[model samples]
Target: MPITTEPHVAAKPALTTTVAREYVHRAALSEVLLTGWNKTGRDAFKVTAQWPRSHSFYVSEHGMHDPLLLCETVRQASTLLAHVGYHVPLGNQLSWSRVQFAVNPYALRTEGTPADIQLHVTCSDIRHHRGMPVTMSMHMEAVRRDCLLAVASVRFGSHSPAVYQRLRAGKGDVNEVFAQAPQPPEPVSRSTVGRLRKQDIVLAPTPDRLRWQLRVDTSHPVLFDHALDHVPGMLMLEAIRQAGHAIEPARGGAVMPTSMDVSFNRYVEFDEPCWIEAEPVETAAPSSDGRRTIRVAALQSGLCAVNATAELTDTVSL
Candidate 1:
């Protein structure tokens, strides 16, 4: 089958329905954010998505869409492009290397209805194998009815089943590893993590006060929609979000993410405790709008598994 790259055109409303769950490697249709995509030029695409006003997992932060939702949208859009644009097989495994996203806080404000988004994505640094894409990075801007919502990037490796099996040698059985995943630890306070439910909190208190243990709940409908041998990237990303709130002084329980730049150095196994730590990067000199930067890391097996730097702000310009 050949995937065509036609010139860009206006998005069709009829294509607004969520795409197949498998296209983005998600288990549930609700987890799918992308509506559709059209190749605009070589390595360029236009992808459409929707952000519901109310979501159980990606809840609103002070009436604004969750920044991690933007990250998820970018992840899904990029993955979808990998499949339709580059013809990557659904059986292939995608190991994300990095995810970087920065959203315009003002643009995330929810109106009286759901938000429709259009992303202009361009891929680069592509590596091919046997005529199929092996790895690539996507840079895109998320727009909402002409308002720019976010700019993001995602880099991942596409591995065939054989290569993935070799990579996961011992943990190749996803179902077994998923079922064997450790029980989630007691979560931090809802107010502390800016979450309403204990299940949504991804951090457990530690003796150090500044550090927390990563909470992995395999039963999570959204995060663990479908299971795998290793801890998924999105879970680690949520850990960073909780840690950021834990590090900040609570004020009206409102702090939305402005940006997040993260890199995955190694896989976070389901069997170990990954320590999450956060430190302020720019505490003394805050931005005019009260934005602050924080550095967060996930450590496991005495090694850094993931690292991220993110910006936070309390105000959402409506």
Candidate 2:
């Protein structure tokens, strides 16, 4: 009889603390939403965090947590996966392709009591070419005391720092470009933006019902405590939410976002006139609870910068 040999498979290396340290930064604990994390599997992690009451980012004068904070939470959780076993390179610039986040409007408040937030994250849809990871996707669920607060789906790509630096160099110094004070638009009716206060309204209506202008006041204590070279991504997300509120009136007189899918095609610079346009996407009839979807786009220099689709529901008084 002829002898046959089988090929042997090599086992994956176990995760080590040293390797984790290279990707996880301690500074994020104070600056970002990350508080701590624990490895649960080869591609899964459990993250813990608490919303800050007075952080320069994401805090509102009303003491309510901004919906944008959920996006950051999802970003941090995805980064945590890089430490355990994902092939994320150190010092790489993380970019998003698509992000979808959904929240339970009734459980959106996070001001008075310190809510213990737990995030369960799983990394999947990893695509590699030439033995290098080109893209990956993550799914996360945020909970407080067993109550589902939010869920998110995010797709990310890693870019070399050299490429990012070279691209940004063409634009003026980042600090100088973003240092301009926010210019508030002429006062508009509160109902125009579905906001109760003038300070909270971020959109200025135009003659066209579907078109509005971006009104960013960098001087606002909560929205612009720090300066930058461009409009922050959070502001773009808020603009979409506010635009949805303006276009789609909630059946019960309160517009609460229940779901959102957003994609950023480019950055919106501060010096340019950014226009926001919103329209209703025909979908199945509104649910019994009055949930409906709106499509919004942020355009700069006649180019689309950010596109979003959001679902809103009436506020449920607790």
Candidate 3:
């Protein structure tokens, strides 16, 4: 089938990501969709997929489905319609995406069946920012085996032509990239950096320790949707990472997460407000050599949702 690159107002050259080749699996795609697809734009779509249940790309020793990967699936599927109907051209590089909210049932202690997942998504309200057009937001959900796993609203935007070209030429200004873009209507918390919505804080604390909380709101991108009720395993890890960034002292030091060991206790969902608390339990030698250890805990309703230990290293100054 024709990939959804046709019918744009501007005949912008069709482009796809190298990352797509890595993530796209014909067998998985077929198992999820049941029917093969040609890239075509439709008003709505419901595709399915399955998890390996053994091997995994990152965490998940049993090959369980990943929340972030699920988000990627919905994102690609939703944007495929845009590529066919709207004029936004795909670029080789995708920048950091700001997740407005996500709701995953699999994260809520529900068994997942990827091949049986029912993905429902709709695209609308087009607008332009920084010379790039975007679908105001995406409303998406994932269901499988009679259980809803997740629902989320995700925001995506591309760099301006000038920014893209400059970066491509190796002459983009780093300061500009670090500068804050337009702030959202909601105010982020003082303890958080990248973003904050009520109890949820993004990029908070330091690289050594981190924590966050979940709040109830219609704007929550994923967890608010009706599939499953609780946070996913991957999101839990990311929350730790974001929280760690918030705690790490900004004295211009490089710290990157190298490893993590985590365990899930109970479900933390969007049904009500919940919080994540994390802190440093260990650190490496001061010789600037060796890995540093950090401890984290996520709590909901004053109960432990998840706990983890992370390994970090300082390569250089930030």
**Top TM-score: which candidate number?**
1
Better of 1 and 2 by lDDT: 1
Ranking by lDDT: 1, 2, 3
The Cα error of candidate 1 at residue 268, in Å, is 0.5
lDDT of 3 by residue, 281-307 (tens): 653445355345667777777787777
Backbone clashes for every candidate come to 0, 2, 44
- Whole-model lDDT for model 2 versus the true structure? 0.71
- TM-scores for every candidate against the unseen true structure: 0.93, 0.75, 0.40
Tens-digit per-residue lDDT, 33-63, candidate 2? 5667777887787888766655554544333
lDDT of each: 0.86, 0.71, 0.45
Superposed Cα RMSD, model 3: 18.5
Candidate with better TM-score, 2 vs 3: 2
Best by lDDT: 1
What residue runs in model 2 are displaced by over 4 Å at the alpha carbon?
1-32, 52-67, 79-92, 106-112, 127-134, 180-184, 196-199, 220-225, 249-253, 316-318
Candidate 3: residue 113 lDDT (0-100): 37
Off by over 4 Å in 3: 1-43, 61-64, 85-87, 92-97, 101-114, 128-132, 159-163, 166-318
